[model samples]
Target: MSIQRVVAVVQDGAEPFGLGAICEVWAEPYHPDDDNPVFDFTVCTEHPGVVTGRAGFDLVVEHGLEAMADADLVCISPKHDFDHHAPAVVEAVREAHERGAWIFAHCSSSFLLGQAGLLDGRRCTTHWRYAEQLQRAFPKALVDPDVLYVEDDRIVTGAGSAAGIDAALHLLRRHFGAKVAATAARRIVVPPHRDGGQAQFVRAPVREHEAETLAPLLAWISGHLDESLTVERLARRAHMSPRTFARRFRDETGTTPLQWITNQRVALAEELLENSDLGVEQIAQRAGFGNGATLRHHFTRVRGIAPLAYRRRFTCIESA
Candidate 1:
C-alpha cells in the first residue's frame, strides 16, 4: 500500500537513534526535488506525555495510541527495556497490522512485535545481540540475526544502528521508487541503496585473519574489474597455486572470485548508468560483461530490475 501517514510508537526507554532514523527518512521537509513522497508523520505512545528515552534525555510525545488507527505505516522503535512493554501499545500495534498498516520493528523493538503476535511463523529479525532472546521468547518466530533486515509479509525488522536506515530505505524504494528513496538518502547523507540481505557486521574469525593479507589484492582487483580476472590469473599474481588461491579468496572475501568480480562490474555499470549517458553496449564492455546481453543478464539477476529500468528510475540523479 502507498505510505502517507506514518506513526512511530515510542515507549519508555526508546532509543534515540532508532526513532531519529525513522524521522530522517519519512518525516523529511519539502525539497525542490520532484516525485519524492512526503509523509504525515506522528509520534505516539500508550499515553501522550513525556516519554523517557533510553539514553539520558526524554522526548515529549503529543499523540496517544489512537493516532495509529489510520496510519499507513507504524514503526516500533527499539528501546533499552525492550521486554518491558505496555499492554496498550502492543494491542495498538496488533490492531494497526490487522487493519493492513505496514509494521516495522527496529532492533530490540521486534520483541514488541513478538508480544503483539505479529512475528509468529514470520521470517523476522532483531539486533544480533537480541536475536537469540527473541527466538527463545517466541519459539514460533523465524529469527535470522545475520541479515541487515528481513521483510516478511508486510512486517519489516531491521538490525541496530545503520541497518535501521537500510530497512527504511528499502520501504521507500518498495513503495515510492528508487528516485524517492535516493533523495531521502542524500538528504540524510547515507547510501541510496543497501540490499536487505547484506550481512550485519558479524564475520567469521577465519575471514578476519585472512582479510588483511588479501586487502591489497582486493583493491587491485576492484580497479581492474574490466580485465579477465580468472582464479588462475589472480593466483599467479598472488604467487600461489590456483587451488590455494581459491580457498584463501573464499575465506577472506566470503564469496567466490567470480561472484566478487561480477558484483564489482555490476556496481561500475550502475555508476555509469546513473552518472553518464553511455549506451548499454558501451557500459557492458566497460564493466567487463563484454556484451549488452551479458550485462542485462547479470544486472537483472543481481538487482531484480532491468538496466534500462534502473537507469530511468535514477537518471534524474545526475542533475540532483
Candidate 2:
C-alpha cells in the first residue's frame, strides 16, 4: 500500500528522539532527484498546543487527533504512562486501525496499540525492559522482545528508541523499494539496514564475581571472533572445566559462548560489508563464517537481509 499521508501522535512525556525518528524519516523532504517519496506528515496530539517531553522540554504541536483520520500511516510516539492514555488518542488509534491505515508504534507506544485493542492476537514488540509488562498487561498479544520490530498485518511495533528508525525504514523499503530506502538512509548517514536483533542490545544483569572472572576472557574472545571458539577451548583458556565455564559464562553474559561468538562474527561482517569492496565469500571467510553460504544463513537470520543485499544498500564506496 502506498503511504503518502503520515501523522505522528505525541503527548505529555513523549520522547523526543522517538518522535524525531518519525519526523526524520517521513516528514523531511529530500532532494527530488534522489527519487525519494515525499510524505504529507503532521504531528498531532489530543490537546493541540504544548506537549511536554520526558527530557523537560515542550513541543508546539498544532494538529489535533482528528488529523489522523486522513492519514495513510499513523504513528504513536513513546509516552510516559502506558496505563493511563488519553481516551481520544486511544480511540483515534483504534479507528485508524479499523480503517486499514498502517499503524506504527515506537518504543512503549505499543502499549497504546494494546490500549486500542489492536495488538490482540497479533505478534508485537516494545522496548526489552517493558516487554514483560506489555505481555502481562495484554495477554492476547504475542510479544517478541528480541526483534528490532514486529509487523503483524498493518500494525508495526518497534523496540526501544532508535529502533524507530529501523521500523520506519522498513516500511519505506516495503513501499518504495530498497533503492529509495537506501537513498533515505544515505541522506541520514545511517546504514540502510542494521544487522542483528535487539538481543545484542538488551542489558543483562551482571554478577560481580562472574563478571570479574570473565572480563579477560570476554575481551580476548571479542578480539578473536574469527577463530573457532568452542566452550572447551574457552574453558581451557580460562583455566576452568567446560561445565563450570559454561555455567559462569551464562551467569555473566546471559548467552552461550557459541552464540556470543556468532553475534560478534555477524557484527564484523557488517563492518566489512559497509566499508570494504570484498565479495560475500571473502567477507564470510574474514568474519569466520567459513563460506558465503554459511554467512548468508546467519546474516539473514540475524539481520533479516542477505549479505549482498545489505552491502548494496549500505556500502560506502562509490564504486561498490
- What C-alpha RMSD separates each model from the true structure? 4.7, 6.0
> Ten-residue segment with the worst summed lDDT in candidate 1?
202-211
Task: Give per-residue CA lDDT, model 1, range 12-112, as digits (tens).
Answer: 88899999998888788777764567789999998789999978999999999999999999999888899979899899999999989999998889999
Query: lDDT of candidate 1 vs native?
Result: 0.85
**How high is the CA lDDT of each candidate model?**
0.85, 0.83
Error of 1 at 300 (Å): 6.7
Q: Could you tell me the lDDT of residue 54 within candidate 1?
A: 75
> Per-residue lDDT of 32-90 in model 2, one digit per residue for the tens?
77867788999999999999988889999999999999899999988887567998899
Top candidate (TM-score): 1
Candidate 1 local lDDT, residue 310: 80
Per-candidate TM-scores read 0.76, 0.66
Candidate number achieving the greatest lDDT relative to the actual structure: 1
